[model samples]
Target: MADYLNNNAGMDWDDAIENDGQEFIILPEGDYNFTVTDFERGRFPGSAKMSPCNKATLTLQVKTEDGIASIRTDLILNRVVEFRISAFFRCIGQKKHGERLVMDWNKVVGSRGRAHFKPRTYTDRDGNERQANDVDRFYDYDEKNFPAEDDWMEITGDADDLPFN
Candidate 1:
């Protein structure tokens, strides 16, 4: 194999991509159109606020002026997390008022609606103050009353034509 380390004669520290000191855009504190882009399972180490628990990481794509912003929310799988789960299902076009219904969580990936984002501030590892966006709640969006662009676009085409394929 060729020695790759010997080919960096013109390399400079200033030309390197800076991953640190990156700015995080905080969404304005308000309701915005959002979609459930992905889901993941994670574990939380023991903490003073609560015991270690399994959490469902729901990645949300919120519509913003610049395009879209990704925000993650961890829902601990415990008794206290029922309300959040229920609200999430309801936002995905599930009926809440009349009769009980079963929700297929797997099909919730393309669910879109209005999500309330709240501003949260915390100290970073370097003792620097940082701002983050938190999902407060989700609401059923009325397309008739307030029509907006659908965040998740459904592509009806051959699967083989996809770039990933």
Candidate 2:
């Protein structure tokens, strides 16, 4: 965080916050048992330049040989991408094949399943090469293959639980 601030001192403090040395695992490209830890509706830049759009953002916690790793995926809710949204629901044990879209997305949280990841390379604004483990696909989970709750990533803290100043 300090290094970033040093490199761009003109940047706004709000735009450049600290990572706080948080430890995270960058999972290798592969499939693993995962749980839906968080789900939310988020606004993101659309393909049309500055145009914004809403999407269902999912944070999956995958248990791997290294440790529990966090993987994020977005499902566009637009009519054109309904298939993607259905696929996401199927992976999370919600809707089945040929099933209509009629379920609470909130119920998706805490659901466990298999997630497939693939390594993708992209150039950042700084023209530096970076690699990301992106979700390639998701597999339906069998109850027998489910990991114990303890095996999944745990959220240790919440801002609401913190003492106020």
Candidate 3:
């Protein structure tokens, strides 16, 4: 973080506040198990396809041989994307197919699921190109997809019981 503030404070890549090394993890486009590490409730303004509605932004963390990759996905609470909402829930075991259930955002974090992530290239508003991973599809949770005991990623630090300050 210090390096980012010191050297890379501006748009110039040559400048860096500090030399904080960066690791780029490029996940292949395929099926992978992921855990919901974060969730946020947000609102979306009306768009051409639908009216303004509540949105669930989820941060999914996938463990791989290289490292951990974080991908964010937004579930728009609108009829146009209703199937996506249902699919996400089903993938995380929060809901079953052919069933109606309330979206319990409280239990989202720490939940594991399966998804197909693919690389995406998009031009930013500034016309600069950017590379990112997008959730191409969500697969229903299955026993075969569950990670083995040795596959779990160990996160450093111990703040499990502490409340956010």
Candidate 4:
């Protein structure tokens, strides 16, 4: 495998690929490249403070000769304060295709923290209204009227994409 390191010694990654089996690979701290494949439109369930600005980029590549592939994701932890965040990709259909990347965050306040999700609303060009999805909820968080410092935040979803068989 090629050394997954950048010129600056930062860990580089691609997030758009997936392996056959379930496994986790720890990555060193650094900047990485990612692409957006699919995402879930609901609040990520966990102990990380989440903002509408939170987004994940996935990068994918495949080794034609060996049939090997490499993938990575960069989780930009851009919260107002220190907090814990957890995320994973859950496939929706039984065919084991179409995955939903779910993330959860818990706000860290001094010593205590609170669980929160993005506020949601719906609007139609012709005047129709509808409920927002998880992605929409995150977008709403990005667009703020008052624009509080804490309002605009982001986090990177960086991980190694392990390919199966």
Instruction: Identify the runs in model 1 with alpha carbons over 4 angstroms from their true place.
Output: 1-23, 46-51, 95-103, 141-165
In order, the Cα lDDT scores of the candidates are 0.71, 0.73, 0.83, 0.28
lDDT by residue (11-71, candidate 1, tens digit) is 5666866336324568989988777777777886757767888778888877567656778
Q: Estimate each model's TM-score.
A: 0.67, 0.70, 0.77, 0.19
lDDT value for model 3: 0.83
**Model 4, C-alpha of 89: deviation from truth (Å):** 20
Write candidate 4's Cα lDDT for 1-165 as tens digits: 122323225334864543375232222222222112222223323355545454443333212234322343334445642122222221111112243323432211111111122223578887886432122111111122223343212433544533431
TM-score, cand. 1: 0.67
Instruction: Name the runs in model 2 displaced over 4 angstroms.
Output: 1-20, 48-53, 147-150, 153-165
lDDT assessment of candidate 2? 0.73
lDDT by residue for model 3 (96-148), tens = 89999998889988889999999998999999998898999999878677846
lDDT of 4 at 138: 12
Number of backbone collisions per candidate? 0, 0, 7, 39
Supply candidate 4's per-residue lDDT for 103: 42
User: Order of candidates by lDDT, top first?
Assistant: 3, 2, 1, 4
Candidate 2 has which clashing residue pairs, if any?
none
